[model samples]
Target chain A: MATETAAATGGQASPIALEEAGICVDSHGGAIGLPQLCPDWMGNQIFWLAVTLVIIFFVLSRIALPRIAAVLAERQGTITNDIAAAEDLKVKASEAEAAYDKALADARSDAQAIVAQTKADIKADLDAAMAKADAEIAAKTAEGEKAIAEIRAGALDAVKEVAKDTAREIVAAMGGQADAKTVNAAVTSQMKG
Target chain B: MATDVNGAAEQSGGLVFHPMDQFIIKPLFGDGGVGIFTVTNITLWMAITVLATIALLVLGSSSRSTIPTRMQSIAELAYGFIRKMVEDVAGRDALPYFPYIMTIFMFVVMANFVGLLPGAFTSTSHIGVTAVLALLVFFSVTIIGFVKHGAGFLSLFWISAAPLPLRPILALIEVISYFVRPVSHSIRLAGNMMAGHAVMKVFAAFAPMIIISTGIGLVVTPLSILAIAAIYALEVLVAFIQAYVFTILTCVYLKDALHPAH
Candidate 1:
């Protein structure tokens, strides 16, 4: 192949011949094409150095760098917009969170109020029932006391009538000798005492 | 030996030396493509490109605020952009692989951009550099595929998209496609870089000649400048495109690895 020949020829060139030809050669048998390439390691170093420098410098200076800078600038603008948006959202979220907590507290108090109202209503009902029972008990006690006083008065009147009848019978049985006048006097005296 | 003095003279002043020629750079050729190839320039450029990218990213990302400053915002945006790219292409499951994708994007973009700098080396122009990157992707995808899919990963080659009669032929083609990934990946980058630089060099060689020839040659100077500018713009576009392409391909390859279908 052409490449193989070039490689072979390029490898076999002697130092003196290469120098005469104004080419610097490396020990690896490759001739440095440009006179700018020194015969020492310096030559090889310089050649590649120039090639690298040229390519990097060219690409960066002209194309890649500008595009990158443009992209960066655009991205920066977007980020600023995004940060501003996020801060706004965060503030809104905090307000919403506070409102939510307040609403929850209100809801809890409303529930407690309902519970307290229910309890008070139940207690009122219970107290009314107890008061009614007490009134009934007092009425029953007063009625029973009136009935007892009437019964006691009736018993005393019955005892007084029975005593008069018995005494009259006893006086008659004892007399023929026992006169009505005497009996009446004795009974009247006893009654008087 | 046949020596043509006229041809030599014609090419003599026209030749633009490599940027690394300034330093005592050494070349190491592996599976040689351009006869005797050295990677000294490649290594150096890669180092500088990486360092520059890191410095920019680090400096940019170091300061973060609720209302980001210009540099901080730019850095965050780049980070988020690459993050979104990975998420979109590779899916949420590939979130863990963000670091790799980000790194690849930064390195490729940096390499491409660095080539635009005056007298700076374009690391991606060399086949060896691109090849290594491509090879790394190839190996990584292969390993991940095998690990995730086990022996079933082999079934990926047998996709039945082709007609039943041509299934075997199609499968063979598929296999070859998989093998050709590294070549295509590397060649795309290397070829683009080489062509762009070569054109620029050819134009640059005329600048001095134009100057030496007095005002007569000066007419070409504007043309040269214009050509350089045009090429520079193209290189910038190429840089972004190459980085995107490389990242996208990585996503696709990773997808195949994580989810194999027969």
Candidate 2:
């Protein structure tokens, strides 16, 4: 590489002179042609390349590759394990959700039962209180009617007594007083008619 | 030796581009001819890549946390990406070869990204390197197919599903294609890396056009710089895509080897 620059700065070597040297490059460092085709360099590159390949082969096969393979396999295993764990966690979460739903449903049913019981109890108490109040109202209405009937009978009987006494007093005052029985009979007949 | 001879000469008082010069392998310690085992820029960059791979793969995952940190995530992403590709393209039976396929992917991808750094040498761009990588997959897959299935592996090239009349022709094509896999696989990666780098260098050469001619430079300089930036961004994408293509192609071939059914 430096030879090319040197040739650019310095003078060109005579073709024959550089050719007689039996080398690829002229003394001025410029290549006679494409250096890749140069037989002089092929041997060196091929030889070193063989050594380099062998060294690389050994380094990779014996050490690097196996190490890398282990790391990769380990990573793969770890990923698989993590996914499995996630799946397990997911299953557990669903189970917990199911349990929660079951408990909620159970509580809802229990609340409905309690509400029904309370409603039924209140209805039974109201029905009994209504029945008791209706019975009391009927009893009071029958007693009040019986007491009015008694008062009327007593007043009618008293009116008959007073009519007989007034008849006897009027007869005596007129100087032709009828008997009490007769007056009572006559007033009863008149009241009857 | 490169025969293009595209040398830089300021005496011409014009643009002298040496785009291929960056691919040249030079000794790290001193100026000398590169021997087979010479420690050149290739070695330096390859070492750097290997270190980066290790650091990312080994130390990054040292924690082995169930929860990955950033570096650990990157390492794991790479591992899982290739592992899935191999499994999907090949069969479950191909898992035994996971480490081998993983090594190639890590090497190619790391070298590509590392090369993208300014002044870095791209190891995957060289045919020598890519060819070797491809051939290893080719040869190993071939051997595995033969060892596992014996003569039955030849059926990979023999298409019984085709009508008997055209079977031979189709078989011939299949045989040719099967043989050409390594060539195509290797060249695809190298060519992509090389071509992108060369285009970037070509554009970069014009970046100093203003110094040469203010009149033409005003138009050329900014355009060239923009082109380089755009190509650089594309190269970054290509670097990863090429690596993916190579590794997946390897898996596809491995599938043929393992199954060889059709």
Candidate 3:
């Protein structure tokens, strides 16, 4: 084939140059016939094909494929871990909210208790003060009543004495006999009536 | 056909370009027959495919980060995509073959995209390459089926649900289809890749041809360029789809192998 191509090239200057340059210028019905008819080229192609394919297979099975698989797996792991972390954080946040709500309820109850106790204490103090004031007023009233009764008794006695004197004088002026005891008795009876 | 075109183009005194010339295999070093040891363009491109795979998968995922870099994300995307595909289509038992399926997907997709570059060879375009791949899947599935089900694996072709009289005919058809899997599998990939690349080349060849005639050149050149662009876009989609189809089909076959009852 080389000699034939060489001889043909000698006759044709352009084809020879193209042939020498490794450009397939002979044009044996394009690529269709070469692989089927040329035993030499076919055998070489198959040989290199096996070599390259084997290399590729091993590289993929051992090195390339495993690496890609690992990367994918690692990415998946990261995603799952992130999701789990988010879930845990969510649980913790709920717990904190629950604690906050409980604390608020406790503080409210404590405040209510304190208010109720303070109110009771203030009421007790007010009642004690009221009782003391009532007792002092009652004592003053009793003293005022005693003083008035004494004054009344003294005045009544004075009035009786004056009546007795007047009655004695009248009896002397009218030239009629009148004793002091009788006059006193009569005045007392009138006052009593 | 190529020589005839070349002769006619020569007689016309126009530039004779061979669009199919890119598919030829020759030695990379010296002028000689391509032996099993000769390094050819197929070897070179296939090596590039391997290196590209390594770069994207091995080195790209070396970081193994929780927050991925761009390359790492791409690597991880491919990993998850193929892993899920295998698991979904082939079941969880097919997970053991995940690496192999992933390797095929990455290699074919990378080879196809790389081939789209200017002046680059598409190794997967060759039946020689695709056949080996398909054959590997074929043999693996068969072996796994036998190992798993023993004589029961043959029941994969037997349609018990069919009418009693149609069972034998249906089984025969199923057996033929089963044997034809590797052929169709390999040809589908190779044919699609070859056809897309060849169409692009044909459109490109026309772009230069427009220069031969000024009046037609004005219209044809722009049209050819536009056509090339359109086809190139479609080829990009084809590249991904072919790879996907190949991998998914492989998973389906693996499923059949693992559970051949249906």
Candidate 4:
């Protein structure tokens, strides 16, 4: 505040002094042409300008820029990696589905083959049992025929013997002997006839 | 009415309000003559711009989170904005100078925005700063053009596609425009900033006058305030646009440097 007052007073006291000194105090009590017309300020402004701009350039190029670039690159890399991983999973899922399909097909064919083989085995067993049963039935019928023929022959012989005994009794009642041989001869002749 | 008071003060040799007083460069410490070593308001504001840039670009984004915070997003937005400007206007080959272009963009934009603060100095509003920046662009582009294309860089001035009779005349015009680039570039930014700030100051001067006046104060005060508000909004847009224009022009000049064909 003191310096401001002093500068203001100095401007009032000797405006010519300030103007001759190249201090930019105009008639309006304001500075003009310091940034454009003044030579001394140029050198200082240029010097500081160079210094500040160089520092800013270095800061941006070396530190801030590279960091941002790295972040962008990292994000891109992650996105690509995720896409590749998803593609790999998709391929694996399709492969699993194919394997399941193949296994199901194989199981169906395997079951069909087993059923066919079992059916063949059962048919062979049934045919063999039927042949054995037919042979046993034929043998029993032959044996029954032989037994009936033997009984009929025995009945014929007993009937011939009775007939001969009856003839002999009749002959004894009638007071005539020697009839057994005759009776036997007569029965045998009748049976032959 | 403030102009009348200022005029009366000037005639009376009393206190005169100089709106341009804000643009003065005085030594921060003493009333001594400013030398090359004297730290002036320009230096202070420039240093502030640098610090603010560091805070935004370095410290704000130090984490580099994939999900950015607001400050980090701002840094990234600025980075991408300048990068695209360099690439789109200057082409892919100009990407090597992206950092330089980005520095200038950030510095100008931050200086302009910070200057909008009530009592802050606007360093970029001075020709000393803008001229240096523009000359740097001009010199670097010229050097790159000479180094890359040798004598062929002169072809930028020669319009080969023009009619044979008017070619020399066209070339003269082109050369004059080419040399005028730095002058116009520096003046454009400084002029816009200086003009906008001066206008706001003028409006502010009116505000006090009209508010204190007996009869017209009621009506004129609100009008001045509204004008200030409206121009303030416009200045905000102008600040961003001027920075953008400076950067894009730099890129365009760089493109010429890299490819000097007509």
The numbered model that scores best in TM-score is: 2
Highest lDDT against the true fold, candidate: 2
Please give, for residues A1-193, the per-residue lDDT of candidate 2 as tens digits. Answer: 3344334433444544444444467544666556776766777888898898899989999999888888878888989999999999999999999999999999999999999999999999999999999999999999999999999999999998898788888887899858878888988998899
Ranking by TM-score: 2, 3, 4, 1
* Model 2 per-residue lDDT at A142: 97
Query: Which DockQ value does candidate 1 get?
Result: 0.01
**Compared with the true structure, what per-residue lDDT tens digits does model 1 show for residues B32-75?**
32212345455667668856765666655444344567775665
CA lDDT of each prediction against the hidden true structure: 0.66, 0.87, 0.83, 0.81
Fnat for each model:
0.01, 0.77, 0.69, 0.51
lDDT of 3 by residue, B1-262 (tens): 4445666777886765555567777677876767787888888898899999999998888877789999999988889999999999999999999989998999899999999998899988888889999999999999999999999999899887888899899999999999999999999998898888888888887786566988888998899899999999999999999999999999999999999987
TM-score of chain A of 2: 0.76
State the local distance difference test value for candidate 2.
0.87
Q: Which candidate has the highest DockQ of all?
A: 2
DockQ of each: 0.01, 0.42, 0.34, 0.23
Error of 3 at A107 (Å): 2.1
Per-residue lDDT of model 3, residues A1-193, tens digit only: 5444534543345553644444343433333233333444667778988998899999999999878877788889999999999999999999999999999999999999999999999999999998998888899888888988898988888888887788778886898788778877887888789
Task: Supply candidate 2's per-residue lDDT for A191.
Answer: 87
Q: Higher-TM-score candidate among 3 and 4?
A: 3
Give the lDDT ranking, best first: 2, 3, 4, 1
Model 4, range A1-193, lDDT digits (tens) per residue? 2234335555354544554565564444465433345555666677777877898899999988887777667777888999999999999999999999999999999999999989988988888888888888878877877788788888888888887887777777788894688879987898889
Q: What is the C-alpha RMSD of each candidate to the true structure, in Å?
A: 17.5, 3.8, 5.3, 7.4
TM-score of chain A of 4: 0.53
Q: Could you tell me the lDDT of residue B68 within candidate 3? A: 94
| Candidate 2 chain B lowest-lDDT run of ten | B1-10
Model 2, runs deviating above 4 Å: A1-22, A161-181, B1-8, B11-13
